[model samples]
Target chain A: MATPYHLKIVTPERTVFDGPVTYIIVRSTEGEIGILAHHMQIITPLVPHIITVYPEAGNVEQFTIGGGFLEVGNDTTVVLADSAERASEIDVARAQLARQRALETIAQAKPDIDLIRAKRALQRAENRLKLAGHSAGGMTSA
Target chain B: MAAGGLKEVDRRIKSVKNTQQITRAMKMVAAAKLRKAELRAKKARDYFEQIQAVTRRAVSKGGAQKLVAPRTVQRKGFVIITSARGLAGPYNANVLRQAVAKMQEVGGKNAAAFAIGRKGRDYLAHRNIPILQEFLGVGDDPTLHQAQAIAREILQQYLGGEVDEVWLTYTKFINPLTHEVRTLRVLPVEEPPAEESGAERSYVFEPDPETVFNDLLPRYVEVVIFSALLESKASEHGARMTAMDSASKNADELIRQMILMRNRLRQAAITREIAELVSGAEALE
Candidate 1:
């Protein structure tokens, strides 16, 4: 295995994940970016997506994160997300319900209703569903 | 007569017991809330540190205009955070008193108060301080949105030159047994020490570092506000838990004293009856 680097994912409420990981794949604003040990220092904004991590000696862990910033420094990569939760923590039933509600609201498309809010809601639900291992169709893959 | 006195004492005891129960329950609730709030505050420390590191790097690399330069201290903005509800011993009082003192130091007329909780607003209102903004009903659990709203208001005032400096007054949670009310200067961002500046590697800026720094400044402010809110909430819960615990103990003491008095009265009445019975028996003989 390659040299492991410290990977820490923090949200406003708490630290969701922190450990040494050999490989990390995160969805940045540009697209999916992968990191390994000794990655050059870089900073970028992140989008709402799932982050997959391969630890040195354990099963791969995944997290669903909202938009925030990512910084990769010497031997350490930090993800400062507005909100983040482990994939296993996501409730599939709740995500499905939320998605259904958002779809219905979007289909109605009344001028009085907020389309942007509906879209954001749908995005969050889809993200949760995707993180929970459910097949959410027509969304960008991390 | 003894029975009547016993009944009254029992009633009083029952009332005291009820009050003790209520206080005990409140203390338990506050203890649970304090645990959760402390956990949250601890967790948020990591995120706050990470942001601070990145922002510090950006601030160091950026030029003068992008930097948050401190201006002359003229008008000041005080963002005072106190408990929405007051049963928390001196939690609200300590914070409000410090806030008022700080505002006075800045000259009352030059201080524009931004009250985050009901207690602070009531205090400022009573003092007739000019309120820049007031937010109420921020319960024990504060959300990030609330922090963002407060940050936006303070940032606007600072950027618009309404206030040259912005200060935050809140309770800093030290431990369950101790919390101290302190004020922090938030606006005109403070620069990190020189020793901490060596950690940054030659980082690549996507849209340039200045723009990123400018964008990050407001978020830093928001995070600071959020941190203060979390600490204050934890302190509030801790203070309430301590206060309720003491109150319950005092009720227990009162109940014990009342019971002791009732037993003495009953003993006296019984002795009097026995004496009368013996005297009547002797008279019949």
Candidate 2:
């Protein structure tokens, strides 16, 4: 078994998670990247996506995160997300409502409403919806 | 001297009581906000502390040397963060005072400002200081996007040579009862001294260290500004809560004094009426 690495997920509001994890799969700007023990030290930016964490003994954990930076160095990986929420903590109904609102906002494209911001909001809400829905149905679709 | 009428004293007491209720409510609201703000400020510091680690490593590796090269500062930009409303007591004044003093030292005409709160914008405008940008309605909870927008403007100005240097001023939240105004030199990003010389570890750059540093520097600036905004928000709430608490207490004291005076005046009026009644009875006899 591979040794566990320290993984910390921090947001502006609080530290969402911090513990030793055997592996982590995060969606980066480049693409979805997985890190294990002894992964190369590199820094990358992340997109709004789901982060899957495999702890040593407990069941796998998942989180929905917004854009931010990730640094892997010295066997420690730190994820400073703009915002983050655990999969269990996400509200499906609220996420759906937000996604619908974002779509409406982008469709309107009013000068006051930024199209990029609305699109990002939709992406974040969709990420949360997916993460929240995945556990309900036992399908482990990547 | 004629003692005040009972009706007037009653009216004054009623008005004071009404004001006291308002202040008490305000204190409660501010206390609730302060709790949330303090929590957020502490969390924001965690992000800042993590970035500091990244920045320190990058700086030690000479990643930010190009960005931090000193240049002659002919013009300076001040990013002043205060509160949108005035009920925060001296919170806005303390931050604005330091910013204005710095601006005056650098010459008002040569100084430009990016005001984060309505109070800062209005204060700087009245002082004849040119405001490059004004962000209003950010309220007690400022978002990362708001911080990014403000940082982008300051970065653009600094990079465009419009401003040779930038300074960020805000109230730093020390505790619920104490806060201090602080100013940080933001532009021409200074390379922080590495904590340990031999503790550096080799970091593999996926896309070259310089490119990562380039992307990281702007984000670092955003994080700094965001954290400062969070601290200022906490401080503002703290100040408002303290101010409102004192105001409510003062009102309580005023009401007590007024009630005592009103009772004394009422006693004197009753005494005079009793004496007049006795004299009338005697006259009839």
Candidate 3:
């Protein structure tokens, strides 16, 4: 059996998770990468998505991550995430509101506004809503 | 004479009580500020991690920049950080002491000081310490702009060759009860080791490396300063809480002692009155 590896998920806000995790999944700017114990050392930029960690055989820790960076080295996977939130902690309703706001910002197409940032926000909030789930969705009429 | 003695004691008690109230209030304020400061400190982690990743790759991987370059060991510049507004205990004293010690250890052409808080400014100024810049009224919430202003000044001095390095000294909050005073070198760009030996990742600078670094380094410094401000904020609160707790305890002891003295004085006055009355009654008989 491979040796257990250390995994640390850090955000600007706090150290979200730090312990021995069995395996890890990451969404880099390029693509998704699965890292296990003794993975080759690599550094890459992170994209906005869900990152899952298997702490035990069945127990999992999932997070909605924003753009940042990740480093895998010496059986340690340190994810320096721009922002990350656990699935259980997210407020589904508020996330939906944020998603809608981001989408609206993207649609307005203001000449000076940072469209990229808005679009990224929309995606991030949408992902959170997807995980969190809420009553308010696609009902433009309501 | 008895009345006069009683009044004097009462005044002392009241003054101590008033000071105790102020200390108690300050402690509460520091605690509230600490919570917010800790949150802000937590928020800035991701940005620094990004820098760390790049550093790891740049220094570990093959890079043109060497340790000996001006980017690494420019060992002298100002450290700008904040201290708490009001005094509860040794919060400002610790910072001043720690900063002085660090500078002393460096032991060469002394770095100038850029003070942020009222406490640090007053202490440093009174000692005739050379101050590069003084910023006050940072208030509770410090903005990136404030940091930018300070960073700009420090960067100018560094680029102008007035100082070869810049360092920042501040108290970093470890927890609610404890804070560690730390000194971090901010200027002269430092990079980390590469991802793997012989892994050459080419980074194309938009305008130029020099141009980008000039902008990036200052922004980086500002971010660092902003973080330090938050850390100091939290530390200040922690220190105040401890200080206030002790002050309140002292006040309680002082109050207890004063009450004892007052009671004894009243008892002695009563005794004297009774004795005088008895002597007069005997003389009349």
Candidate 4:
């Protein structure tokens, strides 16, 4: 069995998870990376992506995080996200509604509407939907 | 006449009792809100510390020098955070007073403000200070999105050369009963002190140091603003809680005094009536 390391996922709102984990896989801005116990120290900005954590053998948990930073120190690995939600905690109906609203707003493209914000909203909604096992409505073309 | 005086005291006691009820209710609400705000502030502080540490480490490694380098102060921008409503004792007044004092120190015409609450906006406006923007109704709980928007505006002004220096003024929460107003510079990010830079490990910055450093600068500012918002929120709630608690106590004291006076008046009236009756009976005999 791989050695366990202390891992914590923190957001501005609260700490999402704090425990010992054997492994964690996250998509940093550089690319997909995985960390094990006693890894070299590194700091990287993360995009909005799913973070996969393995607390023990055959046990896997996933969380969707809004863009933030990841720091691997000697004793602890911390993920600082603006927002994060465990797969089980995501509200599927709310994600769907948010996605629908974002799409409608983009379609209308009003002068006063902030397109970048709408797109980011759509992206977050899709990420949540994907984590919740929804198909994301196949709207990737937008 | 004694009866009339007694009735007047009763009416006053009732009014004071009514006022006490309202103050008690307000205290309870403020207490509940303060609890939530305190919890959020505690959590956000962890994130803030971590981010600050990392940013300091990066800066010590000679990253994002341009952003960190200080410039000549021409125009100054103040982001003053207060509350929307009053009744929070001196919560708003204390912060505004300090902010205005700092602005005067920075020179009146060279300073402008970005007001984060209605109270701040009104105070600045009443003083005839130029306000660049006003954000109202942030409510008791501030969200990260609001912080991001405020950060964006501050950065735009700084980078666009509209302002040379940017500062944040808000109340810091020490505890429910204790808080103090603080003003700190936010722009041209301050470098970490040289003494603490020792024994720092060199970490690999992803996608090259420049890109990561550039990205982290704005984010660092955003987190600072966010943490400030949380601190100010907790302080505001704490101030309101203490203020309301004292108000309720005052009402309690007033009611007690009035009740005591009414009882004394009642006894005096009874004593007088009995004495009159006894003297009349004696005279008839």
Candidate 5:
């Protein structure tokens, strides 16, 4: 059995998760990376994506995180995100609305609107929707 | 005459009681908001400290040359934060006074302000200080998006060379009853001293050191602004809560005194009526 390590996911508004986890997977700017107990220390920026965590053998948790950074230290791994929400906590309707709005804004291509911000918004909405959909589908992937 | 006096006292008591109700309600509201604000501030502080540590390590490695390098001060920018409304005791006044003092010391004519709240905007405007931008209606709970927007404005000014330096002024929350106005430099990011280990560890940077540092610098600025906003918010609520509490207490005291006076006046009027009746009865006898 792999040793469990302390994992904490924090956002500007609040700390979303703080507990011990046996394994965690997150997508960094470079690529997808997984951390286990006693992983080497490194810091990398994260892209908007879903983070999967295994607290125990059978229990699984997922969260959608906005772009931020992840730091693996000596004893703890920390995910510092601009925003984070549990998969179950994600509001599908809101995400869908946001995605629609972002698409409209990008399609219009108004000079006044920031295209980059709109694109990022779309990415976040999609990420949330994907996570929410994955969880609602079933425990098949886990 | 006694009856008229009694009526006046009664009216005064009613007014004082009304004022007391308002202050009491305001105090309760502020207290509730303060609880939420304090929790947010605590969480933000943790993130802020972590980011600061990471930035320090990055700076110690001599990355992000443009941002870490300090230039000669020519023109300065001040980001002043204050509450939107008044009646929060000296909450707005304390920060504004300190901000103005700093502006004057830094060369008033050369300083421009990025006002965060209406109070700061109006105060600086009255002083004829050049306001580069004004953000109003932050409301009770400020979101990270608002902080990001403000940071973007400051970054634009700094990067465009419009301002040589930038300073942030806000009230720092110490406790529920204590808060102090603080001013700290934001632009030309201060390089924190390296860790005491004295041994350089070759840590892995995902893409490259330069890229990570560059991204980290701007993010650091955003985090600083966000955390400061949280702290200032907590302080504002704390100040308002304390202010309203005392105001309510004063109103209570005033109401008590007025009620006492009304009772005394009523008694005096009754005594006067009784004396006149006795005198009339004695004259009839």
Candidate 6:
């Protein structure tokens, strides 16, 4: 395998992922970005989305992170999540329920109540549910 | 002064020494808490930078009037300041003094006070500095919940148009060794200089920009308060450690002086007895 780059995923709650990874893909406010050994130094804000990590010598790992930022410089990719949970760690059932409730809330919210925020919440929960291999795909990503 | 008056000084010295020891222990505990506080602060910065970047983009796109600027300054506002406890030094006094000067300045009459930390709260109250709210016993160890509560209070006030501005006064921890008293503008949403969030990266929000920012902005405010709390906490510990170290040193010097005084008194007594003895011998001869 090519020399693995340093990858660190951190949240205020915990350090979710830290290791060397050969390949990784991150979804940000910009879009999905693939990182390898020699990516330029980039610092950008993250949106609610999924992250897929292909370990240097193992199967891929997945995660969903809330709004935060990423500082990628040198051979390092640091993800600072407002909140983050590993696909293996997040309870799929709970995430689905959260997705349902948020969607319902969005449907019933007052006019002044923000539709975008409710949608983002739905997306965040659904992102986790789908990544965790839920069969339903949250009624959006079909 | 009589020789026995020295005993009173000795007793006072012992009491001061005990107090210093307790202060020293408290300083250590604060130092440990400061470490975590710093991490939370640093983590919070990343979140702010991201939100700020996005907000700047949205604002710059010519949607200023459409989006609500809750913090746009109008009349009066609240400034929350946090200070330290267990006074062995100017730790609390320095911050409160700075707070006084600031409240008199930019705040004018409109700038109300939300003084956190006991010492700060008392100082403002005593001066009859119109305090909108006060949070005491926040302690050297501050919590995220504390930050949230503070945010909620500020938000309620801002949305209700009760205040048009907001600020915070506390010491900022530059390092474990450096703490500086500061008053940070918390309301009117002083947007820091923006980084180039990609224009190409930007697309319409799923529903709209205003909708996204409205939710994010409040969270952004929460995060900012959280950061301040963290900064103040670290500063408190740094100040405590410094204060305790100096206090302990002063006590050591005091003890040395006390010992020297006792030694001199004992020597004086010895000389007097010797003089009496010599005189008695002479009389016998």
The top-ranked prediction according to DockQ is 4
Worst 10 residues of 1 chain B by lDDT: B58-67
Ranking by DockQ: 4, 1, 5, 2, 3, 6
lDDT of 6 by residue, B74-119 (tens): 5555455556465436767777788778877876766577778777
Candidate 4, residues B179-252, lDDT tens digits: the string is 88999888777767887556556677787777777778788888888889889999988998889889989988
True contacts kept of each: 0.72, 0.58, 0.19, 0.61, 0.54, 0.04
lDDT per model, in order? 0.84, 0.82, 0.71, 0.86, 0.84, 0.69
lDDT of 3 by residue, A1-118 (tens): 4568988887645688888987888877557888889776665666788898988444887898976657676656777665689888887877878888887887788755477778
Docking class of 6: incorrect
CAPRI quality level assigned to candidate 5 from its DockQ score:
medium
Segments in model 1 whose C-alpha atoms lie over 4 Å from true places: A30-32, A93-124, A139-142, B1-14, B64-67, B106-108, B199-202, B264-285
Query: What would the per-residue lDDT of candidate 1 be over residues A24-86, giving only the tens digit for each residue?
Result: 999876779899998878777777777889998899988887767788889889888887877
Candidate 5: regions farther than 4 A off: A1-6, A20-23, A36-41, A54-60, A105-119, A134-142, B104-109, B196-201, B274-285
Which rank order by lDDT, best down to worst? Answer: 4, 5, 1, 2, 3, 6
The parts of candidate 3 lying over 4 Å away from their true place are A1-5, A19-25, A34-38, A52-56, A59-61, A104-113, A134-142, B18-77, B100-116, B121-164, B173-179, B189-231, B278-285
TM-score of chain A of each: 0.81, 0.85, 0.86, 0.85, 0.84, 0.85
TM-score of decoy 5: 0.86
Tens digits of lDDT, candidate 6, A53-138: 88887788888887665656466667767778876787877877878877787878755547677777888887887777776442
Of the two candidates 5 and 6, the one with more favorable TM-score, higher being better, is: 5
DockQ result, candidate 6: 0.13
For candidate 4, the per-residue lDDT at A77 reads: 90
Pull out the clashing pairs in model 2: none
Query: Each candidate's DockQ score against the native complex?
Result: 0.60, 0.51, 0.14, 0.62, 0.52, 0.13
Q: Mind giving the per-residue lDDT tens digits that candidate 5 earns over B1-285?
A: 788888888888888888889988999999999999998899888788878766766566655577777788789999999989888899999999999899888756799999999999999899889998999998888888888888888888898888889999998889989998999888777766556313444457778777776777788888888888889999999999999999999988888888888888888888988999999999999
In candidate 1 the C-alpha lDDT for residue A129 amounts to: 90
Question: Candidate 2, residues B1-285: lDDT per residue as tens digits?
Answer: 325488888999999999989988998999999999998899888788888777666666655444566688788888899888888777788888888898787645688998888999999899888888888898778888888887888888888888888888998899978999998787666655655424556666546667666767788889889999999999999999998889889998999999999999989988998999999999999
Q: Please provide, for model 1 over B83-130, each residue's C-alpha lDDT reduced to its tens digit, 9 standing for 90 to 100.
A: 888888888989988999988886456888999999889988998888
User: How many angstroms is the interface RMSD of candidate 6?
Assistant: 7.4
Q: Tell me model 3's lDDT, rounded to 2 decimals.
A: 0.71
